[model samples]
Target: MHGDRGLTVGGPPNAQSPPSAADVRAQLDILLASPAFDVPARARRFLSYVVEETLAGRGDRIKAYAVGMEVFGRDKNFDAQNDPAVRIEAGRIRRALTHYYLAAGLSDPIIIDIPKGAYVPHFAWRTEPVTDGPAATGPPPETPAASLPPMPRKRIMWLGAGLAALATVVLLVMVFLIPSRDAPVPTAQAPMPGGPTLVVMPFADLGGSPETKIYAQGLTEEVLSQLARFKELSVLGRETSRSIPPDADAARIRRDLGVRYVLEGSVRTAEHQLRVTGRLLDAETGAVLWSQAYDEDLRVRGFFAIQDDVAQKVATAIGQPYGIIARSDERRTQAGAPEDLEAYACTLRFYGYRAALGPASHAAIRTCLERAVDRYPSYATAWAMLSMLYLDEDRFGFNPRLGSPTATQRSIEAARLANRLDPENVRGLQALMGALFFTEQPVEALRVGERAVALNPNDTELLADFGARVGQAGDHRRGMALMEQALVRNPGHSGYYNGVLAQLAYLERDYERAQLLMRQVSLEKFPLYHFVSAIIYAQLGMKSEAAEARDRFLQARPAIFEQWDREMAKRNFRPEDATLLAEGARKAGFPVADTTAAETALRTAAPQR
Candidate 1:
């Protein structure tokens, strides 16, 4: 759903000779100059660059990362895995090419197209346009009527109607063939374009026994239920494909259900052993993206336990963020800023901001999400993303709009609205958990976090976020366990995971361990990272590094010095631990706490004790 979801997978090249260099250049020029290609300068430049590079035999170098930096003005830091700008433009360019071919370039000699799921441009000679003339470069001329035998008026009318009907059929076929992720979904029965889609076909009962059929059916249902827990995937239930045979073609599934991926499997039982084979297919090409065969000694584990374990493994491999489809989808490009604000698409924009947390992207995400919720007030995901953005205003000091609602209040309100709208949505619960944590409700926050994780344990980002929150709130063991599970599921996860892990180590007074973990943290603009590193360095007697880290932290979040205890409270440190951290901060060149403030703190603590 991110980009080019509908384009057909390119098959083998046709037997026709490849277009000559001159013809390829002519076609490129003609398409760019066509009235149908009303693309932005950046998209236009992207098209020209890729086409020229392909012609110059540099197609291998054309990738999302390269296109992003060279053509779209993104810096070297532009991560294609998170930023979808290049991919979105690729889809736009594909649509423009379709429009041009449908109207303006019907008779062009050479066809130049950037195939689906790639940045490389392909060139071929068009089979549709040939003339009585040899290799003409322009539109083929209309044959003179006098050169052909004249037919009766009635026969001519019939021929004209047949040609018109054929053209109508071709138009309809082309419309469905074009990738249209931003288009409004037809209905709930159809897969939403907000994410990649999959259909869990009924698993085949290869053994042809009653018990095996039952197991196959049950496993299929289990896989469906597990995948449905992931918010980013649109899974078609097995009931949608009950009529189709187990061996039905993947293209048939793609055509009927319009899904991008297909999961099909078979189970066999023999000699007290159970074997299951499963495959994940790219629906567009019927190519197997992933496949595995699992064997279990039926005597060792109970049948239901085995079923549950297999189902969970399948969901984790395919449905989780950064999982199979996500990684495959990420390889090219899969994001767009649609003209109309779909609530689901808005969630994707929020992720783009979450990846870097830069203020520039934050403002854009906030604006887009605000408009999305404004248009679709009932959208739970939009409310959830909005809640997180609001919390970041206080957490990361991102909000700059004056006279706005307080970030804490708005975050709480939005999180509540999201949960109210969709009680089971993990993201809604996550937003609520985050808002509660920031408001000094650590117990309630942990309670909600546990439920959120249980509701969708495959959500790696949620796992990492909850781990960071709970670890800071003092449940060190569970926090570390969850973070480790997340890392195992998604090793390419953002640097924030290690950054959080480094903080957990710092809190444990494992100065060397913290320093080691901190070395692996590659995050930018996270002030808390500097704060934790300063204290860890101070504890290790690295005074110069400690002072430098302290200065950077102060440069980013200077107000942390003014409300030291309050800042300590935000991290949910134990009272004694807070004092220890303060002492470390002093050693790292922080000013001594004011005498009046210290006296006020003591008097307040005297009663609480």
Candidate 2:
């Protein structure tokens, strides 16, 4: 049965009762607090607002744009028509509700659901079990219950024990089909929750030769192993996924295995050249997400060389930050909706904040990370990002606890926690390095930073950031190399990369190159950006442009300019680099510092090893 406007649904003819407003609200509270939800803050708010609005009979306000504004913190400028963020969020909320009921809310009295294609949420009472239904299995209506002969007591007990044993084995294969290297794969699915999942089906050998088949198998295994390294992705191991036939299409794999993403490819090996074609698919819809072909001349490259290069390129393309998977998630989760931040989504916010270094985004991401670590205390990436945010608080003036050592201490504590959780996490090591720099332990900081980059040279963001820090620490040439490599990997990288690269150019006496790179930095009220701009313009003898740039820097960073020595120490700049920057600023008509910031920076410089 249904209530007014289909807002209330009855479970069965004899449902106890449709839940009242209080019942729904109570359920909502439980759901929001449940560990099973594991939702970011924005998602929780979306659920609460829609349910509350529907319950209050104000369902008209549940439009996507309205919810986007009131609940998701979107402003009027939000383009609801173009951005499908709200629609994507609705689907995620529905999936979360299903996950919740399947686990934590199995016996709950009321049910809350956002039906397909609508924002109006419906409430229903749990249905009663049917007592008068047909028999579950066995004899038909022709046979009476009393007419059946009874089994012997000993045999019955034995049969019961056998059934229990069979049930246990079935449960393990069907529900916990975890893959291992030496073990056989079960022809069933597992239900390990959290994040998106992937299945790399065995690649086809188009050449159909024994050698080609062996090559394909090895390539497929390598790809699977590479994908497994991305901590956020839940990947089915090779032994388990190998049982899946190379031709097992995405739709069938999804239905049989419950994986969200599928990687399918083929290998064509010839004496002249080897060609590998790969395609990523949305398992649910069988929609292709990404596809590419790699062609390598066999005469020029060995099989192992080609395999390693293709594997590295493909993994980096699909799983790296702002890569295919990241972009796909961006659609499902509005990047602007900052609220815990799943450690997956938590580290992502750093890129957005790093882009502009605005106060609002900083505060929102900070709050999100705090809530995230509270919920998932063992999450290393969340702690790592929180540490960076703390560093930004002093670097960009986002901290309210100014002049206090609390933020710095918190930054160091969080970074250390991240390292304790995952010593190999490059981002965590980066955070630790930043914290070390904050404490004037530049020697340890540089060591940590060098180790971090060495640990994961493939991580583009780390390369860019470490480049900037090293440049500041008097290694402009080495820093320039790292930043350039990062820019190649991430073409759509943040403006900060260009900003740092520009400073390095200035240090190298390439004022023309510095000015060219400087023009690329957006005017977002970033004090350091304009400060460098002023120096570059003055060097080029553009007097009026230099004056304007100096004014912008002064207006945005009056405090930093006044306490120049402290800022220098905070930045961890090497003495030589600090001196060069100060000289440029002096030539740009900026006020001279009360004392030489270079001497202050000298105290923190790492000695030659």
Candidate 3:
């Protein structure tokens, strides 16, 4: 499997918490000092959004359970406020305001309370009646608004004093610029000091303009990159989770990613300001473990600083401080660099190609990938993507200059270069193995794929690829088992797992099964759906249908098959598969061009070659 697979879901008995009161106070102090309460340049920006949302008259309608999702654009099923870091920030926000009230306005005071079972912060005011003394000021006309209506003028005077005190606190608050007292804090328990597991979800774009999606996506990448520094945490890469739609179910995400926690947020860019809000959720129980919002003046230092801020906040909430987890060795090259920005943006479109694209479009994708590589030569993932695109081109017989050795050589080099850049990167390794296998270097392909699996013990893609190679190499039983395991990790995995299944089923003479697997995929949308279907149709007896499918495949493909001269259909693949496909095609009256060409494609497309 190329992505996280075999990840342990349940753990041993939990570690007991320390005594509650003292622990809460200590944690509260830390929380108060945390990013959510204090308005550092970046934190200030986040606070601005919170305040803006609060005042927009939209606050009253906001639901407590849904606040994070509504504010951050996370899936409704995943609550970000439950994250410990987020809760801690909320607590800190409350305490900061309380302190602000006590120290500043002695006469008039206002309190914002976060009621249980509610995600929205609630406001309350305390008042004292006025007296005849100089210390007693008449009510400010809004007398009935007081929560405590004890005495008339006497209570009003006390209320006036309290309001005065609160007024003074407001002055101090102005200087500090803290967040609202009602901000919710996410809950968190400290983890062991070493590596941790983390998932960074896509950031929501709240700039009132959908065009700002690029900025939000860029921020998500930025945050992911920032958090990758901790040698102790096995951070999930963007490629794995970035494709999850914003509205996807949390359970689906949890099952697919095999992660216990999820970090999601939003980004809003408007005028000279940028605001971001993030929350960490415990996927198992769908509780927000931590949450925070950061707003900054983009004009001053640029939004780059926010990345580091998010990293630090996440580290704090998780009880893994950035200073400790992110040692010098773990920091990735900053994403703020100009070249990285463009390349990352380009990479965002990769999934779109998989959804709807033709041969010419795939070529265009290759061109785009090449451009990305040109911008960030050391970007290992981009290189791997380019290699995958090349493989796709080859699979579709679109390789220009039919049967050109140069085409094979280009794929080999691209894969190799990608692996060299990021040795532990599974996709890169898979791409490299695929290139080698396609060129008939089975041994090397297996070795590289094995290494990729080792690097990511839980990666389903690596397992599927490994299985694919095995099946292609005549080890059907073992390969099929691996594919089954990969599917367990991600049932809804796109063509990656299914394509492998179809290939192996065909090779193993399970024509019916192959057809079933092909049908299970989102055929019209997935780029390789038709390709896999074409193989199954040709192998069975439906010659006319196979030919029609083949023609359709070719019409949208490059001209590489013009020289395909291999009799792959009669090879080590399941004999039953060959009989069924050929027989079915015969019955269906579909044309079956050169069966030899189809077989050769199957034989040569194996991961092990």
> Which residue pairs clash within candidate 1?
2-334
Q: Estimate each model's TM-score.
A: 0.62, 0.65, 0.42
Instruction: State in Å the error of residue 90, model 2.
Output: 20
Q: Model 3, range 227-247, lDDT digits (tens) per residue? A: 564323456778666777888
Cα lDDT tens digits, model 2, 1-609, are: 222222222212233345556556666765664555655567778888888888889998788889889987899998887989898778778866775776667756567899987889988755542323555686556757656643332233235445545754674454233332211222321112245668888888899445788778878977877776665566776765867865677877765555678888899977767889998898888888999999988789888888877876777677666667767765655654333325456556666676678878888888877766655655667778888888777777885555544677768877876786568877799899988887788789889999987766667767788887787777889989889888877777746778888989998889999999988877674556898888988888998999999998888777776777777777777677677778788889888674595755555664632
Which candidate order results from sorting by lDDT in descending order?
Answer: 2, 1, 3
**lDDT for residue 580 in candidate 2, whole number 0-100:** 73
Model 1 Cα lDDT, one tens digit per residue, 1-609: 222122223322224335545556656665664434545556779999999888788999999999988897788889998998888788767855764665556655456788989999887655531222344377645877635543422233235445545754554454344222221111111112245778888888889345898889889988899999987677765557576676678987775555679998899988688888889999989889989888998789988999998988888888876578766665434454344325455566566577667777888878877776655454567778888888888777785544445787778877877776568988889999999999889999989999999998878878898998888877766777788888777776646777777777776777798898887776364556887788888889998999989888787778767777666677676665566667677878876484324345555798887
TM-score of 2: 0.65
* Model 1 TM-score relative to the real fold: 0.62
Q: Candidate 3 clash total?
A: 108
Model 1: lowest-lDDT 10 consecutive positions: 183-192
Best by TM-score: 2
The global Cα lDDT (0 to 1) of model 1 is 0.72
Candidate 3 regions exceeding 4 Å error are 1-340, 354-357, 399-405, 494-496, 526-551, 557-564, 567-609
Model 1 ranges off by over 4 Å: 1-194, 205-215, 268-277, 285-300, 326-343, 525-527, 591-609
